[model samples]
Target chain A: EADIYQTPRYLVIGTGKKITLECSQTMGHDKMYWYQQDPGMELHLIHYSYGVNSTEKGDLSSESTVSRIRTEHFPLTLESARPSHTSQYLCASSSSDRNTEAFFGQGTRLTVV
Target chain B: AQSVSQHNHHVILSEAASLELGCNYSYGGTVNLFWYVQYPGQHLQLLLKYFSGDPLVKGIKGFEAEFIKSKFSFNLRKPSVQWSDTAEYFCAVDIMNRDDKIIFGKGTRLHILP
Candidate 1:
Protein backbone atom coordinates (compact mmCIF):
# COMPACT_ATOMS: atom_id res chain seq x y z
CA GLU A 1 0.00 0.00 0.00
CA ALA A 2 1.14 3.56 -0.59
CA ASP A 3 2.47 5.26 2.52
CA ILE A 4 1.25 8.72 1.68
CA TYR A 5 -1.75 10.00 3.65
CA GLN A 6 -3.84 13.16 3.61
CA THR A 7 -6.22 14.23 6.33
CA PRO A 8 -9.73 15.65 6.14
CA ARG A 9 -11.08 13.66 3.23
CA TYR A 10 -13.66 16.40 2.76
CA LEU A 11 -14.00 19.92 4.11
CA VAL A 12 -16.60 22.65 3.88
CA ILE A 13 -15.77 26.03 5.32
CA GLY A 14 -16.90 29.59 4.91
CA THR A 15 -14.84 32.07 3.03
CA GLY A 16 -12.03 33.84 4.93
CA LYS A 17 -11.50 30.87 7.22
CA LYS A 18 -7.96 29.69 7.74
CA ILE A 19 -7.26 26.08 6.95
CA THR A 20 -4.39 23.69 6.76
CA LEU A 21 -4.30 20.53 4.68
CA GLU A 22 -2.07 17.89 6.17
CA CYS A 23 0.02 15.43 4.13
CA SER A 24 2.40 12.85 5.53
CA GLN A 25 4.38 10.01 4.09
CA THR A 26 6.22 7.20 5.81
CA MET A 27 8.19 6.23 2.70
CA GLY A 28 11.03 8.58 3.64
CA HIS A 29 10.94 10.15 0.23
CA ASP A 30 12.83 13.39 -0.25
CA LYS A 31 10.58 14.79 -2.96
CA MET A 32 6.96 15.75 -2.35
CA TYR A 33 4.34 17.63 -4.35
CA TRP A 34 0.90 19.21 -4.04
CA TYR A 35 -1.62 19.47 -6.85
CA GLN A 36 -5.02 21.11 -7.15
CA GLN A 37 -7.81 19.95 -9.39
CA ASP A 38 -11.35 20.96 -10.11
CA PRO A 39 -13.93 18.29 -10.77
CA GLY A 40 -13.48 16.76 -14.22
CA MET A 41 -10.53 19.08 -14.91
CA GLU A 42 -6.80 18.64 -15.10
CA LEU A 43 -4.57 18.74 -12.10
CA HIS A 44 -2.30 21.72 -11.64
CA LEU A 45 0.92 21.67 -9.70
CA ILE A 46 0.73 24.06 -6.78
CA HIS A 47 3.80 23.46 -4.67
CA TYR A 48 6.64 21.04 -4.16
CA SER A 49 9.49 20.36 -1.75
CA TYR A 50 12.81 18.73 -2.37
CA GLY A 51 13.56 18.10 1.29
CA VAL A 52 13.51 19.71 4.67
CA ASN A 53 13.55 23.51 4.32
CA SER A 54 13.23 23.29 0.57
CA THR A 55 10.06 24.48 -1.12
CA GLU A 56 9.30 25.76 -4.60
CA LYS A 57 6.34 27.14 -6.48
CA GLY A 58 4.98 25.04 -9.31
CA ASP A 59 3.59 25.89 -12.75
CA LEU A 60 0.24 26.97 -11.38
CA SER A 61 0.00 30.00 -9.11
CA SER A 62 -1.68 29.36 -5.80
CA GLU A 63 -2.37 31.44 -2.74
CA SER A 64 -1.53 28.56 -0.45
CA THR A 65 1.83 28.03 1.18
CA VAL A 66 3.57 24.87 2.24
CA SER A 67 6.28 23.99 4.74
CA ARG A 68 8.59 21.01 4.97
CA ILE A 69 10.18 21.08 8.39
CA ARG A 70 10.15 17.30 8.70
CA THR A 71 10.93 14.64 6.15
CA GLU A 72 7.59 12.91 6.63
CA HIS A 73 5.36 15.93 6.76
CA PHE A 74 4.45 18.50 4.10
CA PRO A 75 1.40 20.54 4.94
CA LEU A 76 -0.32 23.21 2.84
CA THR A 77 -1.84 26.23 4.51
CA LEU A 78 -4.36 28.76 3.30
CA GLU A 79 -4.34 31.94 5.32
CA SER A 80 -7.82 32.85 4.24
CA ALA A 81 -9.91 30.54 2.17
CA ARG A 82 -12.19 31.65 -0.61
CA PRO A 83 -14.69 30.03 -2.87
CA SER A 84 -12.10 30.17 -5.58
CA HIS A 85 -9.89 27.96 -3.46
CA THR A 86 -12.49 25.22 -3.40
CA SER A 87 -11.03 22.20 -5.12
CA GLN A 88 -9.53 18.80 -4.56
CA TYR A 89 -5.98 18.85 -3.26
CA LEU A 90 -3.80 15.85 -3.87
CA CYS A 91 -0.48 15.08 -2.21
CA ALA A 92 2.16 12.83 -3.65
CA SER A 93 5.69 11.68 -2.95
CA SER A 94 8.33 9.96 -5.04
CA SER A 95 11.86 8.76 -4.75
CA SER A 96 14.67 10.98 -5.97
CA ASP A 97 15.68 8.45 -8.57
CA ARG A 98 14.70 9.31 -12.12
CA ASN A 99 11.77 7.46 -13.73
CA THR A 100 10.28 6.41 -10.40
CA GLU A 101 6.51 6.63 -10.13
CA ALA A 102 4.90 8.78 -7.46
CA PHE A 103 2.54 7.54 -4.76
CA PHE A 104 -0.53 9.62 -4.09
CA GLY A 105 -2.71 10.31 -1.13
CA GLN A 106 -6.51 10.02 -0.93
CA GLY A 107 -6.83 13.78 -1.51
CA THR A 108 -8.82 16.41 0.35
CA ARG A 109 -11.93 17.87 -1.27
CA LEU A 110 -12.29 21.40 -0.05
CA THR A 111 -15.40 23.47 -0.51
CA VAL A 112 -15.23 27.10 0.54
CA VAL A 113 -18.67 28.61 1.02
CA ALA B 1 8.05 24.18 -21.70
CA GLN B 2 6.89 20.57 -21.57
CA SER B 3 3.22 19.70 -21.95
CA VAL B 4 1.07 16.61 -22.29
CA SER B 5 -2.16 16.28 -24.23
CA GLN B 6 -4.99 13.75 -23.95
CA HIS B 7 -7.24 13.68 -26.99
CA ASN B 8 -10.49 12.50 -25.43
CA HIS B 9 -12.28 14.30 -22.66
CA HIS B 10 -14.89 11.60 -22.16
CA VAL B 11 -15.39 8.14 -23.61
CA ILE B 12 -18.23 5.67 -23.12
CA LEU B 13 -18.00 2.03 -24.04
CA SER B 14 -19.85 -1.20 -23.49
CA GLU B 15 -18.42 -4.20 -21.70
CA ALA B 16 -15.92 -6.33 -23.60
CA ALA B 17 -15.22 -3.45 -25.94
CA SER B 18 -11.76 -2.51 -27.10
CA LEU B 19 -10.31 0.69 -25.66
CA GLU B 20 -7.76 3.16 -26.84
CA LEU B 21 -6.98 6.60 -25.45
CA GLY B 22 -4.71 9.00 -27.25
CA CYS B 23 -1.88 10.90 -25.54
CA ASN B 24 0.78 13.15 -26.99
CA TYR B 25 3.56 15.16 -25.43
CA SER B 26 5.76 18.04 -26.48
CA TYR B 27 9.35 17.21 -25.59
CA GLY B 28 12.38 16.76 -27.82
CA GLY B 29 14.82 15.04 -25.50
CA THR B 30 14.63 11.85 -23.56
CA VAL B 31 11.38 11.48 -21.64
CA ASN B 32 9.64 9.06 -19.32
CA LEU B 33 5.98 8.44 -20.10
CA PHE B 34 3.31 7.40 -17.63
CA TRP B 35 -0.39 6.61 -17.45
CA TYR B 36 -2.35 6.93 -14.23
CA VAL B 37 -5.88 5.83 -13.42
CA GLN B 38 -8.30 7.15 -10.83
CA TYR B 39 -11.50 5.37 -9.99
CA PRO B 40 -14.37 7.19 -8.43
CA GLY B 41 -13.49 8.33 -4.91
CA GLN B 42 -10.05 6.80 -5.20
CA HIS B 43 -6.58 8.18 -5.45
CA LEU B 44 -4.49 8.12 -8.59
CA GLN B 45 -2.60 4.90 -9.28
CA LEU B 46 0.02 4.00 -11.84
CA LEU B 47 -1.43 2.18 -14.81
CA LEU B 48 1.77 1.84 -16.80
CA LYS B 49 5.03 3.53 -17.71
CA TYR B 50 7.66 3.48 -20.44
CA PHE B 51 11.24 4.48 -19.79
CA SER B 52 13.48 2.65 -22.25
CA GLY B 53 13.77 -0.41 -24.37
CA ASP B 54 10.58 -2.28 -25.36
CA PRO B 55 8.31 0.21 -27.06
CA LEU B 56 5.39 -1.80 -25.73
CA VAL B 57 4.90 -1.75 -21.94
CA LYS B 58 2.36 -3.76 -20.01
CA GLY B 59 0.83 -2.62 -16.77
CA ILE B 60 -1.53 -3.96 -14.16
CA LYS B 61 -5.20 -4.68 -14.95
CA GLY B 62 -4.58 -5.94 -18.45
CA PHE B 63 -3.66 -2.54 -19.83
CA GLU B 64 -0.78 -1.61 -22.11
CA ALA B 65 0.77 1.40 -23.78
CA GLU B 66 2.99 1.86 -26.80
CA PHE B 67 5.66 4.47 -26.98
CA ILE B 68 6.32 5.98 -30.41
CA LYS B 69 9.21 8.34 -29.94
CA SER B 70 9.12 9.65 -33.48
CA LYS B 71 5.48 10.66 -33.16
CA PHE B 72 5.87 11.89 -29.58
CA SER B 73 2.91 9.78 -28.51
CA PHE B 74 2.16 7.14 -25.91
CA ASN B 75 -1.35 5.83 -26.21
CA LEU B 76 -3.10 3.49 -23.76
CA ARG B 77 -4.97 0.45 -25.02
CA LYS B 78 -6.98 -2.45 -23.67
CA PRO B 79 -8.30 -5.30 -25.76
CA SER B 80 -11.45 -5.92 -23.73
CA VAL B 81 -12.54 -3.59 -21.01
CA GLN B 82 -14.87 -4.39 -18.12
CA TRP B 83 -17.31 -2.28 -16.19
CA SER B 84 -14.81 -1.94 -13.41
CA ASP B 85 -12.47 -0.15 -15.77
CA THR B 86 -14.59 2.96 -15.63
CA ALA B 87 -12.29 5.67 -14.36
CA GLU B 88 -10.34 8.76 -15.24
CA TYR B 89 -7.08 8.28 -17.10
CA PHE B 90 -4.25 10.76 -17.09
CA CYS B 91 -1.20 10.87 -19.31
CA ALA B 92 1.98 12.29 -17.89
CA VAL B 93 5.49 13.04 -19.10
CA ASP B 94 8.74 13.57 -17.26
CA ILE B 95 11.41 15.30 -19.30
CA MET B 96 14.71 13.67 -18.48
CA ASN B 97 17.54 15.92 -17.25
CA ARG B 98 15.14 18.83 -16.91
CA ASP B 99 13.17 18.90 -13.65
CA ASP B 100 11.56 16.45 -11.29
CA LYS B 101 8.03 17.68 -11.81
CA ILE B 102 5.86 15.42 -13.96
CA ILE B 103 3.57 17.15 -16.41
CA PHE B 104 0.04 15.76 -16.56
CA GLY B 105 -2.50 15.95 -19.37
CA LYS B 106 -6.06 17.17 -18.99
CA GLY B 107 -7.21 13.57 -18.39
CA THR B 108 -9.89 11.43 -20.09
CA ARG B 109 -12.91 10.10 -18.29
CA LEU B 110 -13.87 6.59 -19.34
CA HIS B 111 -17.27 5.16 -18.54
CA ILE B 112 -17.92 1.52 -19.14
CA LEU B 113 -21.50 0.34 -19.41
CA PRO B 114 -22.49 -3.14 -18.47
Candidate 2:
Protein backbone atom coordinates (compact mmCIF):
# COMPACT_ATOMS: atom_id res chain seq x y z
CA GLU A 1 0.00 0.00 0.00
CA ALA A 2 1.05 3.59 -0.60
CA ASP A 3 2.25 5.66 2.35
CA ILE A 4 0.05 8.63 1.51
CA TYR A 5 -2.82 9.64 3.78
CA GLN A 6 -5.80 12.01 3.62
CA THR A 7 -7.68 13.12 6.72
CA PRO A 8 -11.44 13.03 7.21
CA ARG A 9 -12.15 10.29 4.71
CA TYR A 10 -15.64 11.71 4.68
CA LEU A 11 -16.85 15.17 5.61
CA VAL A 12 -20.11 17.08 5.65
CA ILE A 13 -20.07 20.83 6.14
CA GLY A 14 -22.52 23.67 5.77
CA THR A 15 -22.17 26.21 3.00
CA GLY A 16 -19.87 29.15 3.68
CA LYS A 17 -17.87 27.21 6.23
CA LYS A 18 -14.11 27.32 5.93
CA ILE A 19 -12.33 24.00 5.75
CA THR A 20 -8.96 22.52 5.09
CA LEU A 21 -8.14 19.06 3.73
CA GLU A 22 -4.87 17.60 4.90
CA CYS A 23 -2.53 15.43 2.84
CA SER A 24 0.78 13.93 3.88
CA GLN A 25 3.20 11.42 2.46
CA THR A 26 5.97 9.36 4.02
CA MET A 27 7.76 8.58 0.75
CA GLY A 28 9.67 11.83 0.59
CA HIS A 29 8.45 12.57 -2.92
CA ASP A 30 9.13 15.86 -4.63
CA LYS A 31 5.80 16.21 -6.42
CA MET A 32 2.30 16.22 -4.93
CA TYR A 33 -1.11 16.86 -6.48
CA TRP A 34 -4.75 17.41 -5.57
CA TYR A 35 -7.46 16.17 -7.88
CA GLN A 36 -11.22 16.63 -7.74
CA GLN A 37 -13.59 13.98 -8.93
CA ASP A 38 -17.32 13.37 -8.89
CA PRO A 39 -19.26 10.15 -8.86
CA GLY A 40 -18.52 8.15 -12.03
CA MET A 41 -16.63 11.05 -13.53
CA GLU A 42 -13.09 11.81 -14.59
CA LEU A 43 -10.55 13.36 -12.22
CA HIS A 44 -9.67 17.02 -12.62
CA LEU A 45 -6.39 18.30 -11.35
CA ILE A 46 -6.86 21.41 -9.24
CA HIS A 47 -3.51 22.03 -7.67
CA TYR A 48 0.02 20.66 -7.47
CA SER A 49 3.32 21.35 -5.81
CA TYR A 50 6.85 20.69 -6.90
CA GLY A 51 8.34 20.84 -3.43
CA VAL A 52 8.31 22.87 -0.27
CA ASN A 53 7.43 26.54 -0.90
CA SER A 54 6.34 25.96 -4.51
CA THR A 55 2.73 25.52 -5.52
CA GLU A 56 0.95 25.86 -8.85
CA LYS A 57 -2.61 25.79 -10.08
CA GLY A 58 -3.60 22.93 -12.32
CA ASP A 59 -5.43 22.88 -15.63
CA LEU A 60 -8.85 23.01 -14.04
CA SER A 61 -9.72 26.19 -12.21
CA SER A 62 -10.69 25.71 -8.59
CA GLU A 63 -11.59 28.01 -5.74
CA SER A 64 -9.45 26.05 -3.34
CA THR A 65 -5.91 27.17 -2.57
CA VAL A 66 -3.01 24.93 -1.65
CA SER A 67 0.24 25.41 0.24
CA ARG A 68 3.39 23.37 0.42
CA ILE A 69 5.11 24.18 3.70
CA ARG A 70 7.08 20.94 3.88
CA THR A 71 8.00 18.12 1.56
CA GLU A 72 5.80 15.65 3.40
CA HIS A 73 2.74 17.89 3.77
CA PHE A 74 0.54 19.60 1.20
CA PRO A 75 -2.77 20.95 2.40
CA LEU A 76 -5.67 22.44 0.42
CA THR A 77 -7.98 25.11 1.86
CA LEU A 78 -11.22 26.65 0.76
CA GLU A 79 -12.12 30.11 1.94
CA SER A 80 -15.80 29.26 1.98
CA ALA A 81 -17.34 26.00 1.03
CA ARG A 82 -20.37 25.79 -1.20
CA PRO A 83 -22.79 23.16 -2.34
CA SER A 84 -21.06 23.15 -5.71
CA HIS A 85 -17.87 22.12 -3.99
CA THR A 86 -19.17 18.69 -3.10
CA SER A 87 -16.77 16.22 -4.65
CA GLN A 88 -14.08 13.67 -3.86
CA TYR A 89 -10.60 15.02 -3.21
CA LEU A 90 -7.67 12.78 -3.96
CA CYS A 91 -4.08 13.36 -2.92
CA ALA A 92 -1.13 11.87 -4.76
CA SER A 93 2.64 11.99 -4.54
CA SER A 94 5.35 11.07 -7.02
CA SER A 95 9.11 11.20 -7.20
CA SER A 96 11.11 13.09 -9.84
CA ASP A 97 12.45 9.97 -11.47
CA ARG A 98 11.70 9.46 -15.15
CA ASN A 99 9.91 6.17 -14.55
CA THR A 100 8.14 7.20 -11.36
CA GLU A 101 4.40 6.71 -10.98
CA ALA A 102 2.07 8.54 -8.64
CA PHE A 103 0.69 6.92 -5.50
CA PHE A 104 -2.78 7.98 -4.42
CA GLY A 105 -4.40 8.18 -1.02
CA GLN A 106 -7.85 7.10 0.06
CA GLY A 107 -9.83 10.06 -1.16
CA THR A 108 -11.79 12.44 1.05
CA ARG A 109 -15.46 12.61 0.04
CA LEU A 110 -16.84 16.05 0.78
CA THR A 111 -20.50 16.83 1.13
CA VAL A 112 -21.68 20.43 1.22
CA VAL A 113 -25.00 21.19 2.80
CA ALA B 1 -3.42 21.07 -25.70
CA GLN B 2 -2.39 17.63 -24.54
CA SER B 3 -5.37 15.35 -23.87
CA VAL B 4 -6.24 11.69 -23.59
CA SER B 5 -9.28 9.90 -24.94
CA GLN B 6 -10.96 6.68 -23.89
CA HIS B 7 -13.18 5.34 -26.67
CA ASN B 8 -15.53 3.36 -24.50
CA HIS B 9 -17.45 5.09 -21.77
CA HIS B 10 -18.88 1.89 -20.34
CA VAL B 11 -18.56 -1.77 -21.16
CA ILE B 12 -20.39 -4.83 -19.90
CA LEU B 13 -18.84 -8.27 -20.14
CA SER B 14 -19.38 -11.77 -18.83
CA GLU B 15 -16.91 -13.62 -16.70
CA ALA B 16 -13.96 -15.18 -18.56
CA ALA B 17 -14.52 -12.94 -21.56
CA SER B 18 -11.79 -11.09 -23.39
CA LEU B 19 -11.23 -7.42 -22.59
CA GLU B 20 -9.70 -4.58 -24.55
CA LEU B 21 -10.08 -0.88 -23.77
CA GLY B 22 -8.87 1.71 -26.24
CA CYS B 23 -6.89 4.78 -25.26
CA ASN B 24 -5.38 7.52 -27.42
CA TYR B 25 -3.38 10.62 -26.65
CA SER B 26 -2.87 13.82 -28.63
CA TYR B 27 0.70 14.59 -27.60
CA GLY B 28 3.43 13.68 -30.03
CA GLY B 29 6.48 13.32 -27.86
CA THR B 30 8.18 11.01 -25.46
CA VAL B 31 5.44 10.08 -22.97
CA ASN B 32 5.05 7.83 -19.99
CA LEU B 33 1.79 5.91 -20.21
CA PHE B 34 -0.26 4.54 -17.33
CA TRP B 35 -3.43 2.63 -16.63
CA TYR B 36 -5.15 3.25 -13.32
CA VAL B 37 -8.04 1.32 -11.88
CA GLN B 38 -10.52 2.38 -9.22
CA TYR B 39 -12.77 -0.24 -7.75
CA PRO B 40 -16.04 0.78 -6.13
CA GLY B 41 -15.34 2.88 -3.02
CA GLN B 42 -11.61 2.43 -3.41
CA HIS B 43 -8.79 4.77 -4.33
CA LEU B 44 -7.27 4.83 -7.79
CA GLN B 45 -4.32 2.46 -8.14
CA LEU B 46 -1.80 1.86 -10.87
CA LEU B 47 -2.72 -1.13 -12.99
CA LEU B 48 0.24 -0.85 -15.37
CA LYS B 49 2.72 1.56 -16.89
CA TYR B 50 4.88 1.89 -20.00
CA PHE B 51 7.99 4.02 -19.77
CA SER B 52 10.36 2.40 -22.24
CA GLY B 53 11.67 -0.86 -23.62
CA ASP B 54 9.41 -3.63 -24.99
CA PRO B 55 6.14 -2.13 -26.18
CA LEU B 56 4.18 -4.67 -24.14
CA VAL B 57 4.05 -4.25 -20.34
CA LYS B 58 2.43 -6.46 -17.75
CA GLY B 59 0.91 -5.30 -14.49
CA ILE B 60 -0.87 -6.66 -11.44
CA LYS B 61 -3.90 -8.92 -11.66
CA GLY B 62 -3.12 -10.12 -15.17
CA PHE B 63 -3.54 -6.67 -16.64
CA GLU B 64 -1.40 -5.67 -19.61
CA ALA B 65 -1.04 -2.70 -21.96
CA GLU B 66 0.63 -2.32 -25.33
CA PHE B 67 2.19 0.93 -26.38
CA ILE B 68 1.96 1.79 -30.07
CA LYS B 69 4.12 4.83 -30.48
CA SER B 70 3.16 5.35 -34.10
CA LYS B 71 -0.54 5.38 -33.32
CA PHE B 72 -0.15 7.40 -30.13
CA SER B 73 -2.19 4.77 -28.41
CA PHE B 74 -1.74 2.65 -25.29
CA ASN B 75 -4.53 0.11 -24.98
CA LEU B 76 -5.26 -2.11 -21.99
CA ARG B 77 -6.11 -5.73 -22.51
CA LYS B 78 -6.85 -8.94 -20.66
CA PRO B 79 -7.34 -12.40 -22.10
CA SER B 80 -9.87 -13.51 -19.50
CA VAL B 81 -11.49 -11.12 -17.07
CA GLN B 82 -13.11 -11.96 -13.75
CA TRP B 83 -15.95 -10.28 -11.92
CA SER B 84 -13.43 -8.68 -9.62
CA ASP B 85 -12.16 -6.75 -12.64
CA THR B 86 -15.24 -4.54 -12.63
CA ALA B 87 -14.01 -1.01 -12.04
CA GLU B 88 -13.36 2.32 -13.66
CA TYR B 89 -10.20 2.42 -15.75
CA PHE B 90 -8.36 5.61 -16.54
CA CYS B 91 -5.70 6.14 -19.21
CA ALA B 92 -3.08 8.71 -18.40
CA VAL B 93 -0.22 10.28 -20.31
CA ASP B 94 2.74 12.13 -18.86
CA ILE B 95 4.58 14.07 -21.53
CA MET B 96 8.28 14.26 -20.94
CA ASN B 97 9.51 17.73 -19.93
CA ARG B 98 5.94 18.91 -19.36
CA ASP B 99 6.26 19.51 -15.63
CA ASP B 100 5.54 15.80 -15.09
CA LYS B 101 1.76 16.29 -14.86
CA ILE B 102 -0.28 13.27 -15.84
CA ILE B 103 -3.24 14.05 -18.07
CA PHE B 104 -6.07 11.57 -17.65
CA GLY B 105 -8.73 10.49 -20.09
CA LYS B 106 -12.35 10.15 -19.16
CA GLY B 107 -12.54 6.70 -17.59
CA THR B 108 -14.17 3.57 -18.93
CA ARG B 109 -16.44 1.79 -16.43
CA LEU B 110 -16.31 -1.95 -16.89
CA HIS B 111 -18.99 -4.17 -15.38
CA ILE B 112 -18.15 -7.85 -15.39
CA LEU B 113 -21.09 -10.11 -14.63
CA PRO B 114 -20.47 -13.44 -12.97
Q: Which candidate should be chosen as best, given TM-score against the real structure?
A: 2
DockQ of 1: 0.81
For residue B74, what is the lDDT in candidate 1? 99
Over all chains combined, what TM-score does candidate 1 have?
Answer: 0.98
Clashing pairs in 2: none
- Assign candidate 1 its CAPRI class: high
Residue-pair clash count for candidate 1: 0
The residue-by-residue lDDT of candidate 2 on A1-113, one tens digit each, is 99999998999999999999999999999999999999888889899888999998988999999999999999999999999999999999999888989999999999999
Model 1, span B40-75: residue lDDT tens: 989999999998999999999999999998999999
In order, what lDDT does every prediction score?
A: 0.95, 0.94
**After superposing candidate 2, which stretches have Cα over 4 Å from the reference?**
none
What docking tier does model 2 reach?
A: high
Provide the lDDT at B106 for model 2.
Answer: 87
Error of model 2, residue B56, in angstroms: 0.5
